[model samples]
Target: MKFTRNASANWKGTGMDGKGTINTESKILNDAQLSFKTRFADGVGTNPEELIAAAHSGCFTMQLSFILTEAGFVPENLDTKAKLAFEDGTITTIHLDLEAAVPGLEDTQFQELAQKAKAICPVSKLLNAEITLTATLLS
Candidate 1:
């Protein structure tokens, strides 16, 4: 199977003063605003790092779900939070916090699966930064 996705960005003016818009193939983001303030400071728009974090979180969680099912466990709930650190004009780290509930699953097994998911997930593989994961099994 193959999948293709596309997103476009347009910018006007200088780096700090320029304004940009981001549009994706899925249309979930249509002309989303992106500016220097948004990327550096607390601005009124979304930034690339924020979007990358969202993608990492979503992809990791979904991969974990599939891994659990394949291992004969059913995931009742899964919540993953991804944090991206951008410093010195480069992405430095990506951290993932995952909390999941799976009935009758051992901590050891869950931990192994979570780690595997973090290693094998497409987004995790694509990112060229330090990746850390904290997995908690909910009671």
Candidate 2:
């Protein structure tokens, strides 16, 4: 499967003083505010890092869901959180914390499938950083 998705950003003025709005093709984030304050400080809006984290977490969870179904395990719930670390103008690491509830799924198999999803997810492949995962199977 091949497809394309895009988002646009508009900015005005200097780096620290400038403000911007981001629009996505899906309209889920239409005209969302973004700025230096939002990125570096606590401001009312979203930033690149936050968006990346969202994308990574969503992608990883979905990928794991597919893998689990293929392995004959039905997932009751999969909650994933992606934490990105940015320092010195670089994204250094992304940590994925996953809590999963799946009936009849063994811990060893769950760990292997979670690791596989983390390795092969499109967003994980797109990023150039140290990726780590901690998967906990909930009984």
Candidate 3:
């Protein structure tokens, strides 16, 4: 299966003066070259890092959910946060934290699922940057 989203930006003037529209629909814009990617965060005007976070978080969560299901457990809720760090003008790493409510899940099983999710998530595989994960199985 394939998934996609498109973005376009128009900039004029200079930093702090030039503003660009992203997707040209959300009306979320970037100005002052603030480095706002102009896509889905900070009022839906997202940046590349935000997009990475979105992809990573969603993929990892789904992977973990599937792993849990395969392991014979049902999760009440599964939430993950992905943080992308960019420094020296390059993305360094993506850190993921997950909180899952699975009544009968053992801690070890949860860790295993998290590891598998990190290893096999499509985003993780596609990214060359390091991906770190932490998970908690909440009762």
Query: Candidate 1's residue-wise lDDT over 1-139, tens digit each?
Result: 7989899999999999999999999899999999999999988889999999999999999999999999999999999999999999899999999999999999999999999999999999999999999999999
The best candidate in terms of TM-score: 2
Q: lDDT by residue for model 3 over 1-139, one digit each (tens)? A: 8977555655666644445544533434323132333432253344667767987999999988888889898889999999898887788999998989998888997898889989999889999898899898887
Best by lDDT: 2
Candidate 1, residue 17: CA error in Å? 0.1
Cα TM-score per model? 0.98, 0.99, 0.76
Better of 2 and 3 by TM-score: 2
lDDT of 1: 0.96
> How does residue 52 of candidate 1 score in lDDT?
96
- Point out where model 1 deviates above 4 Å: none
Worst 10 residues of 1 by lDDT: 38-47
Model 2 weakest 10-residue run by lDDT: 6-15
TM-score of 3: 0.76
Can you write out model 2's per-residue Cα lDDT over 8-111, one digit (the tens) per residue?
A: 99999899999999999999999999999999999999999999999999999999999999999999999999999999999999999999999999999999
The lDDT values for all models are: 0.96, 0.97, 0.77
lDDT (C-alpha) at residue 51 in model 1: 97
